[model samples]
Target: MTFVEELREHAELAGAPLPQLSDGRDRYGPVAAILFAQRSFASVRRRSNGTTLVTVWDHRGELAAWGQAPAVDDVVNTLRAWQDGVPLPELCSAVARYLQAGDPAAAIETLWSVLTDDGEPHLHAIVAAASADPTLRALRPWVSHGTLHLLHATDAVHGVRRGLAFHPTDEDAFKVHVYDGPIGPVQDVASAAATAAATAATW
Candidate 1:
């Protein structure tokens, strides 16, 4: 079956029925629905080129992007990679550094491996939170907040705790947050990284 057809069929099976595209081009929403069906803590996004990306969080709680092509075979392959816990390409891993440095284009290209090199930490780490808690697994599409976040509910008082956070303020600037505690170390790191990168860029 074609990639679009397979997505439609799979989405039906999962009872998430996706909307039909008027021009029949592959869109992020439907693709996301298929990948996220019955599964949470992961998101699928549409690239400018119309390719679909499957996103998860790495061990460090950074966005780990995968699933570039979105062809029927590619979608199936990416899903299998996730299910089997395969590592992302080595080049894909560079996105974390790119993001930390406040480079969205570089990060996106890195995740897509546009230039090709190798990607992310173990895919398992990205999915672990959901795997351990059904409540988490039901969170769907994970709020983008401009960048991807790996979140889990810690305690009732604490609410949702994010391991990593990416905030895109604009095309020219963005922020990356990484932490040890619920929110302390991350705020400091994010502030420092943004200031440092911005300072360096001015020179």
Candidate 2:
């Protein structure tokens, strides 16, 4: 089968089906954009004598990350996993890590998975609490090495960004530091979500 046809079949199994290629060719080769939930996510290209190139974009649609896989099937499987349950920040960061280091292990151990692996349920709690408000949904949360960061789709120059350093002052309170800058304890994820929503509107 041709490249596009094979991609479509694999994507169908992945449950994320392929869309029509826009018929655009760039310096690399023929390119097709992929959207998830109607938002721009990644691109697939045939390049350098039929090699597959997968490029991932940041929320602002900037050139932020890329991943080179052996074939379209590898890309499709990753996409399927991302679609199944991975958070946006994690998905983006995985591609970002791979492109940055050219290491698949780095991608797996980077922002998202690092935060999720602690077995403490912080990622789940934070996400569940954040989901209480839809506006806060715009804020994408990512974590790395004890630090949590946020991103927004409308972000242009740097992408909607926030950072927090969590240090528990007491059982009921944890000191949280903001990316723009911070002070005081957040106490819980709901407060953090509200703070994120308010900040996303203006900051």
Candidate 3:
């Protein structure tokens, strides 16, 4: 089967339909538009028009709850905070330090740290179709157990993985590695559902 077909099958299993890729206008925003969502829950998307849209999708993939934010910066900040599972006050302090650093890459690095930090209750199943590994299949249940968070459709960028110690051995090929985050945290269903909804809108 083709890559798209395979991705569709996996997405179906996750109950999170793949976003539309044909429309240039709706494809992911600039590199700054980082994505975060819980499988089959809610999502948040930063639109091209500078609006952050939060949406909640029901089991049928239909919109359930929706909200728009004109204050895009604030919305993005909130989303990042949620992903980090940190208190708002703490995140605000960290953002303040990051902003004072006056470096864009630093900001991206900070965000990447939160998303893929140790035991992040999320699993990233990045595997090459031709590879010999079938481990990803066994881990699929993590999504249902709320142990999995973001399901990256593709591997992250080079710089994004630099500080996280997640370099792929085959720089040219996809590989799978299991990352452990802080243990046994409950899934924030309400927040995830909203974020998933926003992500679905972008598709």
* Best candidate (score: lDDT): 2
Q: Candidate 1: TM-score?
A: 0.32
Off by over 4 Å in 2: 14-33, 36-39, 81-85, 92-203
TM-scores for all candidates? 0.32, 0.37, 0.21
**Total clashing residue pairs per candidate?**
9, 0, 21
Top TM-score hit: 2
Give per-residue CA lDDT, model 3, range 66-180, as digits (tens). 3454453443443444344543345435532222222333333323322332212223322121111222211111122222222322323321221111222232322222233
Candidate 1 residue-wise lDDT, 10-105, digit = tens: 655655444431122111122333333222233444456676655544543344454455354444444444434554552234222111223433
Per-candidate RMSD, Å:
14.3, 15.3, 19.8
Residue 116 displacement (Å), model 2: 38
- Model 3: weakest 10-residue lDDT segment is 21-30
**2 versus 3: better TM-score goes to:** 2
Error of 1 at 38 (Å): 13
Q: After superposition, how far is residue 146 of candidate 3 from its true place, in Å?
A: 29
